[model samples]
Target: MFNDEPGDNETFLYKLERESEVQKLIAHLKRSKKTYVRRRAATMLGNIAEISDPNERRQAVKALVSAIKTDEDDSVRAAAIDALYQRGEDAFDYLVAEIAEMGGSEATERTATTLLTEWLSADHLEFRMVAATALGERGATAAVPDLVRALTDPAPRVRTRAAQACGRLSDPRVVPPLSERLSDGRQQVREAAANALGAIGTDRALAELVPVTQADEEGLRLIAVDELGQFGSVKPVVVLVDALDDDSTTVQRAAMLSLLELLTTASTEELELICGTVVDELARADIQATVPALLDIAADGTRRRYRQTAIWLLSRITGDRYRSEVIDCLLPAIDKPDEETAQLAEAVLPELRSPELEKRLRVYLSRERGSEEARSRAQAVLDEICDGSSGELVTTGVDYTYVDSPADYTNQHSSRD
Candidate 1:
């Protein structure tokens, strides 16, 4: 089927399939324009492996078999297994053929390790990674030693891929090596470790990772928290809640967001406790990552209600002085432009305003990049300053006292809402 837009052979094959022209598609797929196109065509054919035309099926299968050996993309070629899933006895032949073609050193060892070792010596990083992944996925535990060795590959991508492939096999023996990698200097490597540990999912893996939540570096701890959240349960929740008291606001915020995500599955009481620290759980959990505010909260946040609860808890745990500091600490939120900060006064039951702290009087009327939200906030503060003292123009701090009864901060603070 000729089309207006010229594309690689895969696009033509897809077009032909839509037209229910399977027989002709199979023939053209064999002599593709390029190796990449040939592989994609094979993948689509595998998707429709049950095509009624026997001759067409044979031709598609032939193309797939050729791809298994010749095509460069191991991932696309790997689809053969899925294609053979229901084919039963016939599929068995394809599987055995792949294994035989890959495994050259007969009686002593299986898999493509011998060939792969030879390939690796020649700096074929892509093939080495692909072979390691395929071997591991194929349940060739014998490849674990080779896969682990790939962790030291000069190419970080290869090492990263190898770490992940090792996780897929989930062999106990790889745990020690993977554990050692828990503190890999590379960010990707460290993240990959958390992934491998998650895959391992052993009691040891859980124990090792729980402590990672408290790691001093924000990045590592974030990854650890993220991985732990994957194992979602009240225990991880409790651990995260405890982290809310950590010195780093970043850790506290991750704990809150993860805690919020946990709310999707947590009991109402737990969420209510979280509300005590951050009144804006939903705001903090925004996945759009649209603006810096979202990213800022996603990093480390002091959700107003959550902060209040933390203060209350601190007062109970430590004392009144720390509680005052917690309240004072809220200055950061009050001066910011966010819904979470806006509703905090009512939620926390404490009415405090930044009178001398430049008040952002203007509201963002609309939520867009160029909106006057920031300017409006600035104007509100400036207007208040001007109204309080007309004779002299003051530019420093804006007067933030309630227009009516400043003491009743909740009603005053909530007037806009």
Candidate 2:
């Protein structure tokens, strides 16, 4: 009984029938010398303290409350606090009531407040981290203000958890304080802030995220790119498209991914304009995620540039579904009797599954008769459309078309629509 046999007490707790073993585990916890044994016993006691039946659980919770406040060891105390949550709202409500009652009784009453204070202020990082995490999980919105202040805590980890806790509250008011942390000196803290803002995900949050795209550091920029993608608005499309040219692959890829997300709703014209920036990369076929997105924009040809962009976008698509479109665009361009589009089409045709290039060389003799510059470009595009594949491919850097990058690859750009 003293040993608590790893699962014995827990087994009883799971069944909600450990009145005897619960007492034994509690006593052993008070006497155990090894920290691990005491901690384990404390956890079991906490678990046992929970009864599925409300009336019974009230009594069980009282004993656990006593354990949390009076445990000789810090670990035991922390474990008790954790287990308290499992007892459902009864345990916590009881705990809060106890704290209020203690305030009225003895001024020296070491209540739940006392325990909470100690855990948050303790020198041990894990204790504070766990306490913050548990509070966040509980999602006590009442604690949002306190969590906000903790954002400035000297320990980055604590502050990180605080941001996380605020995020869990999912309250808009937390946006300001949380946004402040985006420029946090610690990368870890910045990442935490990014996650929080992304999770909260309000327009206010997205607006705050916009400037971070140009943050001096690439890591922060990537974080901004990643977080922005969460909202999938074209508002950041220009921001992300600009990033496509970033010197760092990490930043570029992040931007690409963001754009891909935005493309789900972005207009074809918006996508067309975006083509030039992304098509070349698509053609490289290296970043498989951005391939479909480039193709989607390419297919929307309000402007020849978009088609041009599509042609370039086509070079990147190599999937089995992509074979036909790539072949059709290049095939017509080959003999469109125009050199440039013909050359461009030929460059990407191997991307298709037609007879060898030699076999299809003369296939487009009709369309190639005129408009060398025009026909060549048109035929090249036709080839891509003919060989287009269909699949939902992964992409990045998605933003709204009308809001950002209003350069208008087509004759006119529409910001309102």
For model 1, residues 1-417, the per-residue Cα lDDT tens digits are 212233545566677656656556455445554545544454456566357767766665666666556655454455443344334446535544464356445643443556554433334454454555455555667768877887777866567767887788888887778777777778787778777877776656755678777666777777666656544345565566566655666666666556555544445666565444433322233222212222344224555434433322322222232333433343333334565543342233133223322221221112221234434443444445456553134344554442323565677667768
Q: What is the lDDT of residue 411 in candidate 1?
A: 71
Best candidate according to lDDT: 2
Residues 1-417, candidate 2, lDDT per residue (tens digit)?
A: 243344444454434234535545655566666655666755665566434565544555666677666766666666665566555555655664454354444434435344444556666554565455555665556566667777888888789877887777788888999999998989888878877887888878878888888887777788788767655444676677667667677787667656555544346766655444444444443434454445554444443344444464466555666565555454555554335545656666655534333223323333254455544543454455345332112122342122112453242343345
Model 1 misplacement above 4 A: 1-122, 215-219, 229-239, 245-417
What is the Å distance of residue 282 in model 2 from its true position? 12
Cα lDDT for residue 322, candidate 2: 53
Clashes of each: 15, 34
lDDT of 1: 0.52
lDDT of each: 0.52, 0.59
User: Pairing residues by index, what is the TM-score of model 1?
Assistant: 0.38
Q: Alpha carbon lDDT of residue 23, candidate 1? A: 57
